[model samples]
Target: MKSERLELSTNDVKLADQILESMPGFSEKMLQITQRLLNRERQHGRYIVRDQLARGGMGVIYTVYDQDLRRTTAMKVLPPQILHQEPKVSSFIEESRITAQLEHPNIVPIHEIGVIEGSSLPYYTMKLIDGEPLTNVIRMVAREDPDYVRHYTRHRLLDIFLKVCNAVAYAHSHGVIHRDIKPENIMVGKFGEVLLMDWGLAKYVDADDNTAFEEAQDSSQIIEHNPSRTEDGVIKGSLAYIAPEQVLGEPSAIDKKTDIFLLGGTLYQIFTHLPPYEGENMIDVLQRAERCQYEVPSKRNPRAQIPKAVERIILHAMAPTKDKRYASCQDLIDDVEAFLAGRRSGGIRQFRVGQEIIKAGDKSKETFVIISGKAKIHRSVNGRNMTIAEIGAGEIVGEMAGIGQGARTATVTATEDTETLIITYELMLDELRKLPPWMEKIVFSLADRVRINSGYLHPLLLENRIFPLVNQLFLIYAGAHVQAEPDTPISYPLKDVVNEVTMNLGLDMASTTKVIDILAEEGLCVNVAEQLSIPSLQDFALFNDYCRCKMDINTGVKKIKEIQLTKEKDSCFRQIVRHLHEIDV
Candidate 1:
């Protein structure tokens, strides 16, 4: 379990750092030098190439100024060597035309799709993005850089995801399928602008897969469906995020669903800060992606603190089968929105106030999500009832059983009339199917904690354990409802803790209310206007002590039981021995 970091030679590291500081804008400086030496000012007739921004596998990007428009823009041009083939050059030109045709907020719009005059090489001009790619954002998350972490929070990331979904939905509406939906292909602006980039691999259909490019109005701009587009059945996107159908080159299977798979992959990176699949080489990654198997995000980093519902959404969107994925990008967006709003999808049932929806030791088949109203959780402890937690709307009940931890651990009764969405064992599967094994393990372990030694503690010992358990419950309530990292004092409603206490310890309403009052009166907690605040980390301090005390009591009680049985066995042995002696006498 010992952890270590690889040691590097500090000399070279320091040398590089010092040299880099001396020349801060080394790359920009080099680009400037190249521009001046090459005299690239007049290279492109109307657009004056200023600085070379980037070089891709197929083209190089230059920051150019449109002489006619009098604005700065980005121009993509093919390298002279690659422009040797007529078909290759022609296909590149067609791709530019197609990308320029689609006009959407998320899709980068083309300003001009043309060729370098006299050379016959294709080029295009578009808005120069003022941001980094989704790939860089992911890298920042992976590195755990504090500044970036502050920038890319879980909620913020999901917000970005929602925007991306809308963009894809727009593309779908226009009969365009962005075959490549990787993080590298998506640009995120500083002001929250998300642009889906690289439409070279994107396909346009008149209606269906059988739509002929020649018959279409933009026929001259559409490349005559040819083999060069696919080499040995491989497409333009990187292997890591390409869809299964794209990998297998399933004819006519390319559609919005394929992009949905890629969107799922993009989300995978957002959650786990990792691509769905990785390998030493392109072929290796392609093989794994083609297999349509992925390591679930929760499994990859259980401590990532991502919501399980979010994970499930991504998994369903990226289902191996096209039919299994969200029918459209909008469908995926709807589910993500639902999760963000704290709503789950399932069948709902209503319970009247004071009704016992579940009973301790009852068969557990379904988990209930409270959509409204409060509920009391109860359990028998030493011949008396106890409140473990009091739960209200937006909370879950019977989850321990619903997750197959066994029969119900505690009974849940409605404190007031309640409505809950019942996620039965069968449906719970679909909800949890995408979660990592450890996520399920975490739920099971918690259930065990809640049910351990129930109804066994002596009545004299029960009061001490229950008081601290109540405090622990209070902390849980605050955590769920308040800021996780608080800068100011947090005040949570008292009723919330009442439900939590009953949920955890199965205490009755009367007992739970009594304990909350006792803690308030004892200066252990503060109560104001029915809102309560327990100093951070203090609520759980007493609980830890109670746990230790309970463990000692359980050990002592076990020994006492062993001694009583042993004494009875000794007496029985003496009687048998006396009978044998009587026979001799």
Candidate 2:
């Protein structure tokens, strides 16, 4: 079945024209929403221009309706000035032709390319996407949550950029290079769909073609000798997103990683809400781009506190030397996925004795967990060295800042040859969420301990929270002296147990035995002579009551500690304990 499209009134066209006119640098263009509608109708047989979407450097975009097709479409019409420019005209045509061949869900589809009558330039129509450019979203975020820009931006940017990479990777596989990729050329839809736009500078990867080879050779020379060619021509990509090699005109040597660099730059801007490099003019920006070294995103945005994995991804992607960048977009994507999944994205380098693993007040990278060997935490007090704590194998150091303000509270130095597993705050949170409920309780308990004690305990103690809880819970129900054979059925011992309890409730050997005796006396557990077992619950009321008591006590203790440490009221604490007693009794 065909869908129907609506026709627009003259007033609607006038309103659209006014809207386009109000935008930056589009006022003088010959923009008529009505004219655009008429052109769409003439070209496609029947369509209507609903409104102007946006104006770009070379053209104006309008949202239109195709009456016959019953679908919304975008009309990209070149302004007269850009149409007359021979290079731009050729570029527009090439972009349309190239984009039409790209068929990916993440790449907007180009429908048709033609010259509107009475206008000497070419115009193209594409699927009108109902979304905002990625740049706009970043801007909105900057306005709303400027404080946590680093954390939020990195997540959002990585997500969108990964989709961008998937699209560009598909294009590359099809032998196309989108020489221009910037935030302005990316759109994120309401339903989380991402589309890569503007293939204007797209070039085919055919070495056998004489003209292409010659063009490639020329571009290579320009890239090698001139680092300022980025300012020349139409400047296809945003000045900030131009790769260093691209800024130097090295299009011939530009391979997949070149796009990776642009992807990194675009992500950097999105993540930080600021470009990697900024300048007052095109030349200045081009020079900074050519230098190819900028402050890491974490350094630039104090609130950003980028995870080490993300920092590594960005820096590697933006490596000035092509060899230093990721070998392929897929490699970059894999690391990003690893980071998002809360795992080690890659290996960590070993640090020498006395080496500064992390510096105080430096927020560049995330903390590292000692996989092997030992390290010492240091903080200077009154110009003297103070040993805050020593971290042995399996201990996580320098996470205090990462979880909170992201400022290093102290410096960590390796005391011996060490192999540390580095994790970012972003990755940690993701990983923590995936843990089972029992595991989560242990982890949160450890985190709470760290927060309270400030890393004073042995690393082994930190790692034993969950195991200890499980062991203690079983021991409590089975009786402290009860022993089971290796092949003994777990249900036989626990079946008659009464106290619905867990290790989280500060259960110890003695207290656990007392609870078990209470359960036995209460008939919650079945004692067949010397053997102990939990009773089968036809109605889970008793089991539910016991479990609720254990959970309530554990939660209450945690809250009380928090209140005491924070110097807050104990009213909430007293009220909880009072409620627990009433429920349990």
Candidate 3:
């Protein structure tokens, strides 16, 4: 008979009344039972606690009726054991203060905070959401029914995600961070309403150091014959989506980026129909979060058919290291919003084999991205048109004119009937505006370099056109690998590079291999004797040196004569520009 557990169920209350009418010597017992029932129905300072909705380690949530407001609401009450500690008690009450201050559309509002009569437990009333949590909504994404997938398409899912970002961004603005951000903690209303729930772990950053968010949580495990202590190396947030710093317990390191990691994790789940990391139990999940291991969306859910841009966005957003993630919630929102906008850009157009999609020395205002089939790049040199490259789906054509001057330098003919995304003049402008500053600079730099470097590089070297293309890959790898794994060869597996290049880089394996071979021959890269990677830091250094020398060599040289931009060069330039804009910077 634990007093703490002595609460009556709804049916128990009704049973007591029926038993009281049949028994003669139990009036006192009936009086006690009746009093308890009356207490359950009685207003706790004008709040009628109707039923228990949920319970967690921190508190119990109940459906309550607010007499003053004349409406139903949800109330969370801290258990007595937690209230026994004043420090814990203060922070528990602070939850309401912090949440009530955040007047965001997505954050659930707090109506009142006080102790209920006949119970020492502190409680706060809030909006009672009439919808399922995001966990249930996310499960709907993985359902076998085709209609569920159709209705919750990637766009629709991301649209809901943007609203979550809106609320988190608002919290950050008010010197607070919602340390625990997960699907289960979010409410997705039946009518497109999204509410950020549970500010129990939310922390207020000092106004002085804007970057440092110091939210606290007493996630302690009980120990025999000793004071409770938080689990070592375990973060206070949800294990499934906790940031690396949070797992490491780096007090100063927790900030906006910590929230960004959680945001990315949420997006990752939305795209893949799985958590970023999964394990058999809580400890296992916590360990995985600390290690920061996860499969990309494609591997996690192959049928999801997540776009490369979308996948890349989620991965970047969820980078294990804080600095590698987005700077602010706004940065993450802007990027996801921009990627969503680009996916919606331009109408799809179809082409037939041997069709001249673009031609050299001809003025073309439109740029095209192949959604299906293939195209060939050819250039006119001395009196003949020679084939330089062949590209398939996910490749771009006519971007040279889209980025810089209107003159098209290369001829691109469809290798077969193809479907393309035609971005003409104005639409191109819209995508360009959405590009991050670094990406804008990269595109502008490439367009300028192509304009300047094309004069010296011979169109005949087929490898020469490939050089410009591969250099971007090398630069991206050099930066990326060094950040993620400084001692490794930047992941130079032949198959990995080939598939990634073909799938996203808009380059075929044949051309990609040629460039890889040339890079190897130049000593800028070397395959490890018994491994798939290249030779470590030295190779990346060499690759960087070679890129610098090549840029200098081509950029410094002037045209031998008034050389016209060949169709191949023009196509290559446009391809680069399109790629730069389409993917993450």
TM-score per prediction, in order, is 0.56, 0.55, 0.52
- After superposing candidate 1 on the true structure, give the runs of residues whose Cα lies further than 4 Å from its correct spot: 1-45, 117-119, 206-234, 345-355, 358-382, 385-585
Off by over 4 Å in 3: 1-44, 145-147, 207-234, 343-585
lDDT of 2 at 27: 55
The local distance difference test score of model 1 is 0.69
Candidate models: Cα lDDT each: 0.69, 0.64, 0.70
Q: Give the TM-score ranking, best first.
A: 1, 2, 3
Of candidate 2, the 10-residue stretch with the lowest lDDT total is 560-569
Per-residue lDDT of model 2, residues 41-131, tens digit only = 4553455778998775667888877665678899888877665577667767877888999999999998878776655657889987778
Per-prediction count of colliding residue pairs? 26, 14, 4
Greater-TM-score candidate between 1 and 2: 1
Q: Residues 38-140, candidate 1: write the lDDT tens digits.
A: 5555655888789998875567889998876678999999878777766456656766877777777888888987778887667899988889998899899
Winner by lDDT between candidate 2 and candidate 1 = 1
State the lDDT at 518 in candidate 1.
56
TM-score (C-alpha, index-matched) for candidate 1: 0.56
